[model samples]
Every structure is written in C-alpha cells, then in structure tokens.
Target: MSTQIVILAAGMGSRLGRSLPKSLTELSDGRTIMQQQFDNIHQAFGKDAKVTIVVGYKLEYIIDAFPEASFVYNEQYDQTNTSKSLMRALRASSSGGVLWMNGDVVFDPVALERAAKVVARDQSFVSVNTAKVSDEEVKYTTDAEGYIRELSKTVKGGLGEAVGINYVSSRDKAALVRQLARVDDQDYFERGIELAIEQNGLLVEPIDISDLYAVEVDFAEDLERANLLFS
Candidate 1:
C-alpha cells in the first residue's frame, strides 16, 4: 500500500512570532520549513508518497505554495490544538497506515529510514530523543516490552522526549481516532496517544532518533539550531 503522509500545520504558532504560518518560515538556506519537510519526504519515501497538509491559520498561503499536495482544513484551528488537527487527518486518511510530523520540525532524513521500517511493518511508533528530555516537551517511557506506556509532558520518570514525528498503523488508527476525538480541544495529540495506549491496547513503539538532528522550530533559538543542520 502507498504510504500516507500528513503534516499538521493548523496551529497559529504564535510562539514563533512569524507573520506567515510557522511551516512557511524561511531558513537561512532560503527554504521554508514545509519546503524542507516536503523534500525530506520525497528523499525518504520517494515522490510517489501521498502528502496531505492540515491547514487553518492563513491556510491560503500554504495551499498556494504547495498546490501539488492535498490539504485538510481545520476550521477550528484557533480554538483547537494538534489533537483536533491530527484527528481530522486520521479521519480523512485511507485504511492504510500513516506517518506524520509536526509541520515546523526540520529533521534529518536518516531518521525516516527507521520510521519507514516501522511503518512498513504496520507498527505504531513515536520517534524519541533520549539525549534531551525537557520539562516542557512531550516525554515518554516504555513498558517492559519497550512499547510506550506513558506519553505526555507531565509523565514522571520519562526516558526521553518525543521528537514530533510519529506513525499509526492501520490496526490502531481507529482507536487513535476515537481517543483524539474524545480529548479536550486544547490537548496535544500526545494526550490521545496516551489515552489510546490505556483504553485500546495500542502498542506504540518508541524509536530512538537521538543520534539524528530533528528540531521543532518553536522559538527563535530553535530556528537557529535547525538552520545549523545546513551550515
């Protein structure tokens, strides 16, 4: 089955203080964040990979720039969060699995190799960074069998931080969709993953990507670090 790719770009991303959508912010190399993400997808999954971008805040700009890719608009983007954005994407997807990422993340293409293997096997996974576990970032801990047991920012004894890259197999998609729909509007997509693990027996593996560079450009400092990958 063809791999379905989703880029969640609906949030206002006011923290980045960019006039355009956060994914449209240009790097020093002159490529927008989404532009780099599109290139990385093509590099890793090939040009045949189907890409769908979730848009809301200034949706027209994103639509106009990447007209070739499909789009899903989250009309309540101002009031909702990633949970709703991701839910919409999941609902719109086919029965096959999906690999998705936050729109602002500029990541190393090498990480996609592991993600591809996991997705090909129909295993749900979350890319993690054991080297960096910030109190503000989404963190996770694995079970005895190495499946994600707890995922959220407030989890105690977190083994690592999730890197804004994740996948949902065909088997677990419906459970995740239900959880995402039941979550509060302000909740991040991680909340739904955690709930799905507890209520639906969704076994999500945590893939370590610490050795690779994947930066979510949430702040100016983060943007600097993301640009350093090209420097």
Candidate 2:
C-alpha cells in the first residue's frame, strides 16, 4: 500500500506571536519546524511517498518554505481546528491513505516508518500513545487492545497521552475525511476519530510511543522546552 504524508500546518501560533507561520518558526539550527517535519517524514517514507501540506495562518510562509510539496489552503482556518484542516486537505487530494500528522511536534522519523509498516497490512489508522504522562501532554483513554477511546489534554483522568502522529490507509481515508467534515469546525481530530470508531465503526488502532518523547509546541514554554529537548 502506497502512503502519502499530509502535514497539518494551519493553526495560527497565537501564543508564539511571530510574523512567520508557526510551522516556519526557526529552531536553533536555522531549520524551520515545517522543514524538519517534512525531512523527517520523507527520510522515513522515502522519496516515493507523496507529501502534501495543509496551510493556513501565514500560508504563504509554508508555501515558500516547501516549494517541492503540494499546498492546500484552509479558508476557514481561523474558525476551524486541526480536524477541519485535515478534512479540507484530504478531501482536495485523493490518494491512498496518508500519514496524517501535526507539523508542530518533534518526532523520530523511525517511529513513523514503523507506523507505515503496521498500517499497510491492516488498512486501519494507527495513532501514537505514551504510558508516561506530563502536565503538558495530551492524555488519551484506550481499551484493553490499545484502541483509543477518548482524548483530552485537560481531562483529569484518561489512559495515556496522544503523541500526534497517525497513519490512515487510502481505502478509508476519503470516508474518514468525509465523516469528519460533517462535524463542527472546532471539533478536534480525536473527536472525529472517536466518532469514526463509535458511529462509523472504523478501526483506529493505537501504537504506544511512550519511550519516544514527542515535543509539541503549544505555548512559549513549550517552545522553550522543545528547544532544550530537540536542540
């Protein structure tokens, strides 16, 4: 099964307060977040894997940064969240299932490669989870078999943290995007995932990545922590 990579780069870094897009924000090495993410996925998936980026909030920065990849703009990005951005991008570009992921997190390329290997066989979506929890990590609730049950960053209790990387196959990609598009724009990707599992009976599995720390940049403190962790 062929896999494409869709990097969701639409959100405004309202907290970051940078003129450039959040994805284009520079780290220590002068490599932008968008570039690092793109390189990481391409290195793992190989040159054959098609790369498309969903851009909003300083969309031009993303376009200029990654001239090689296809860019899909989200017109309602300010009003919408990541799930809606994903739906818009995937709906516009039809392909085999994609490695749908956030552009704001720092991840290991090898981990993504492992997901691709697993997703190819089952045609099921695979998400990353961690047993370790921090005050900052997004927690998730899963069943005995590691299927994500619920996701919340602020909820008091849950199973584990969602590491923000997902692998979805082409067969169900369209259906999944279509299902999510029907939801309100503010709903998150995990909410859509929960809906798919509950209403549509989609098989969305979880791959625990507790050992691998995924640094997500949400606030100034997060950015500082990521710089320390990834630098």
Q: On residues 115-220, what C-alpha lDDT tens digit does candidate 1 reach at each position?
A: 9888889999999999978999999998899999999999989999999999999989999999999999999999999999999999999999999999999999
Clashes of 2: 3
| Model 2: per-residue Cα lDDT over 1-231, one tens digit each | 346778898888788778777878787778877777877877777777778898888888788777898888888889998889888777877656667778888766667767867766746654555556676666766666767666656646766677788866666676678668877788777676767776776667778676665677777777777777666
TM-score of 2: 0.90
What's model 1's lDDT at 91? 99
Candidate 2's error at 181, in angstroms?
1.6
Which stretches of candidate 2 lie above 4 Å from their native place?
A: 134-137, 154-156
lDDT of 2 at 221: 76
Query: Which residue pairs come into collision in candidate 1?
Result: none
Model 2: ten consecutive residues of lowest lDDT: 122-131
Q: Cα RMSD (Å) per model?
A: 0.8, 2.1
lDDT of 1 at 10: 92
